[model samples]
Target: MIENQIGKRFAEALSDSITDDDRVEEARDNLRQFCNAMEQDSQLGRFFLHPSIPEENKAALVMEFCEKISALEEVRNLMRMLVERQKMCFVKNVSAYFDEVVARRLNQARVQVVSAQPLSEDHIKKLKTMLDRVLGKSALLETRVDESLLGGLKLSVGSLVADASIKNALALLKQSIEKEEVLSEFASG
Candidate 1:
């Protein structure tokens, strides 16, 4: 919860810094790229979070990288703030929060859909429509095929999850059967 609050603070501060809509979009991309890079590269993530590395050095490294990428000053400031506060490990969370804030500002919902097989455009559209009705916002769906789902699909919107997969259904059925067997054994005893 504290980590979430820290991330939200940074995301809100960054959001407040942007004056133009285009800059907000650009900062979103910049932050996503920066956070993904840190997450994908353990060494890079460590360099920022490592205890031995001075905070100033970490800030300098981030500033240089941001300058090279021509990132918005707001993004650079956010990176520096995270480094100084020893919260570099929360970069991904910050990005997620920032994206949520931007999406809220735009009245759009970003959702992820996982299914046993790739869905057709029409199917995705229908799913989006369902999500729109549920979330009361325009839904933007990101689809992925996960064979492990066995059948059907799962939808994740922010913190909410809607699981309709056969695997989940079977698991629930098994739990119910187990409970019934236990109850019968207790009665017999």
Candidate 2:
């Protein structure tokens, strides 16, 4: 809970900084990249998030890395703020929320489409077009093929999920039969 509270605070501050149209997108990308690098290099994540270290030294090291990756001033300032406050673990959460905030500002959405089989370029392009129209904003579609999905497709566009998989169909059928049985019992009562 404490971590979530701290993450929310950082996310809110970052969101506020994104009001300047010129800075939001690039800032979000840089932040995500920084967070990705941190995730990929666990040692770096541990070094920055370690509470045992002197805050100034940690902040300096993070600032140096932040400067090396991105020219976006907004991102640099955000990195400095996180490092100085020793809130570096929340960087990943902040990056995710930052993207959500920016997408909301643009009236756009980031979507993930997963399928058991690979999709052609035409399939992906058509899906993007349909989603953009349905969503009323441009869509950034991330495509993945997970064999566990077991054919059909699963689309997660913002908070809504469209499941067209056989697994979900079977689950729905099972749910419907259960509901029907319950209703029959109530009727007999």
Query: Which candidate number would show the highest lDDT if scored against the true structure?
Result: 1
Candidate 2 stretches with Cα past 4 Å from truth are: 18-22, 170-189
Look at candidate 1 and give me any clashing residue pairs.
none
Give, for candidate 1, the lowest lDDT window spanning 10 residues: 33-42
* lDDT by residue for model 2 (26-101), tens: 7877887887788798999888767788988887887787778764767788788887766787888787777777
Error of 2 at 60 (Å): 2.2
lDDT scores of the candidates, listed in order: 0.88, 0.82
Model 1, span 34-149: residue lDDT tens: 97777688899878867988888888889988987899988988888788778888888889899988898778888999999999989988888888998899898989999988
Q: How many residue pairs of model 2 clash at the backbone?
A: 0
